[model samples]
Target: MKVKLASSYGFCFGVKRAIKIAEGYEDSATMGPLIHNQNEIDRLKTDYNVGLYNNLTDVKPKDTIIIRTHGIPKNDLKDLRKKDAKVINATCPFVTTPQQIVKKMSQENYSILIFGDEAHPEVKGVKSYGEDQEDVHVILSISELDNINFKYDKIATVAQTTKKKETYLEIVNALILKNKEVRVFNTICDATFENQDAARELSKEVDVMVVIGGKNSSNTKQLHSICLENCQDSYLIENAKELDPNWFKNKNLCGITAGASTPDWIIQQVVDEIEKY
Candidate 1:
């Protein structure tokens, strides 16, 4: 079988930066999983003795806290400050752009509409930027736009940094049709768009596609979704151990792609293992 990898895959600038920051500090703990990939987190834990805390309550004032790339809510930052914990803000700059825009637009009385999953940490952080969290709306699909009942003359929309550009644009178009005045910012990261496009292209050329990344990673999931849409035999796996040799038994070509948070070493390992088959 011929194996091909997406042109754009693995750690993006933001994730690399976050990892570098985390590596620089000793006796530090991340506010959450620094990035979604468990393998890298495990490596960091074993090599640097980094700790992961789900909430501030578990962190001590003396311990250095590294914020995850998917930033925390505004109130959570305040709470961290109150606790006097040493903080290393590793929030991706791309994610911060939407947060600033949402806060500014909300302060100006524009209704905020975030085009992303409500449960996602990045989306939750963006939602917290609104003047009133109750007024802010998070819509994952065009259909969800219908559920918004706020009577605002002006609406401002932003998307999660890892969201698909096409999906974001589709939601923005729908918002324009439903609202009188709509201000939209394409908050989706450039790398995400490129990665998705590359994955789609790679999937089309291969008989079976393997998407590597953390299952919980939004960007990785998006990649898998795009791959599946283009290729029927696409599979999503966190590591090479999850790979089933049977999937490649009759396949002539295999495509590989990974999420932004995935490390190069892991991707390489997957590639090596697949080649063995």
Candidate 2:
């Protein structure tokens, strides 16, 4: 049996930078998980004494607060500033691009349309930038676009950094038909595009595909979806412990790809375990 790894996989620039920032601070708490990977979060907790908090109210004034890579809502930052908490911003610059665009466009009276999951932290942060959250619409697909009744002639659209380019463009193209004037910004991260493309290419050449990453990671989920389209036997797992030998019974070549937040050690472990078969 042969094990193949995607050329572009594992921790991206943002995740690496966030982890480095977190490691530099002691007894610091992140607004949310610094990145989606549970293993890496656990390692940080044990090694760096970092903590995680989901709500702003839980943060203490004297404690250092690390902003997540996905970023926080605009109002949340203002509230934090009002407190005495020491803040360390770890938001990816890629995610910040959309937030800035949304803020500027909303100020100019253009209705905001975000191509992403409404519940996602990154999307919520982007939506908060708009002057009025009511004017900002989060649409995951073209079907959702049909339900939106836009009263504004000018619309500005941006996507979550981890979203697929094809899906984002498709929605933007449809939105252009409905609005007289539309401004579209493709905010998908270059790393995300390269990772997905690499995953797709690996899926085509392998007998089976393995996607390793946190289950909650949006980018990881996207990579798994891309792999599933080309390879029916693709499996999504967090670690080698979850791997079932039965899946690789007759497989000669297995391809492995991980999400942006996944660490290199986890990928290496999965590969080493697969080679044992």
Candidate 3:
């Protein structure tokens, strides 16, 4: 079997920046998983001495704390400052843009509508910036928009950086149709668009598709979903060890793609393992 790599795969600029920032601060801990890839996080722990703190309360006074790329809640940052810890902000600029947008628009009295998973850390952090928490609404689908009751005449919206653009547009169109005054900010990351497009294109030509990234990663899951639409044999795996020999049996070609958070080393490992088959 032959192995082919997607045109756009592996680390995005934001993830690369966060990894470099984390590497610079040895003996420090990140408030959360930096970029959702456990293998890379483990690499950082072994090589750079960076630690993970799942909660804010786990952070200690005077500790050097590197904020995760997803960023944390507004109050959490304030609490970190109060703890007298040395804070290293590694939040992706793409994620930070929506947070600032929510803060500004909400302060100006526009009801905030975020098109994303409500439980996601990125959405949680962005929602916390809203001046009026009651006015902020997070929805994964356009159907959920109908359930929201806006207290203000005007509404502002933003999307999760890793979400599907097509769905976001549908949500935006629905908001415009329902409200006279609506502000729409396209917050989806460009890397997400490229990765999804590449994955879509590659999946069509391969007998089997393998998407490499952390299972919890939103963008990785989106890639797997896109691939599955084109190729039924698509699989989502974090590393090379998860690749099953049987999946490639009698297959002529295998296509591989990775999420924005996936590292090149991991991708190469998977490629090497596939090549052996």
Best by TM-score: 3
Query: Per-residue lDDT for 61-111 in model 1, tens only?
Result: 778999999999999999998898998999999989999999999999899
lDDT of 3 by residue, 1-277 (tens): 7999999998999999999999999999999899899999999999999999988889889999999999999999999999999999999999999999999999999999999999999999999999999999999998898799999879999999999889999998988888989999999999999999999999999999999999999999999999999999999999999999999998999999999999999999999999999
The better candidate by TM-score, 2 or 3, is 3
Query: For candidate 1, what is the TM-score?
Result: 0.97
* Angstrom error at residue 163, model 1: 1.5
Alpha carbon lDDT of each predicted model: 0.90, 0.92, 0.95
Higher-TM-score candidate of 1 and 3: 3
Q: In candidate 3, what residue range of length 10 has the lowest lDDT sum? A: 53-62
Question: Candidate 2 lDDT, tens digit per residue, 235-257?
Answer: 99999999999999988999999
Off by over 4 Å in 1: none
Model 3 reaches what TM-score against the true structure?
0.99
**Strongest candidate by lDDT:** 3
Residue 131 CA displacement from its true place in model 3, Å: 0.2
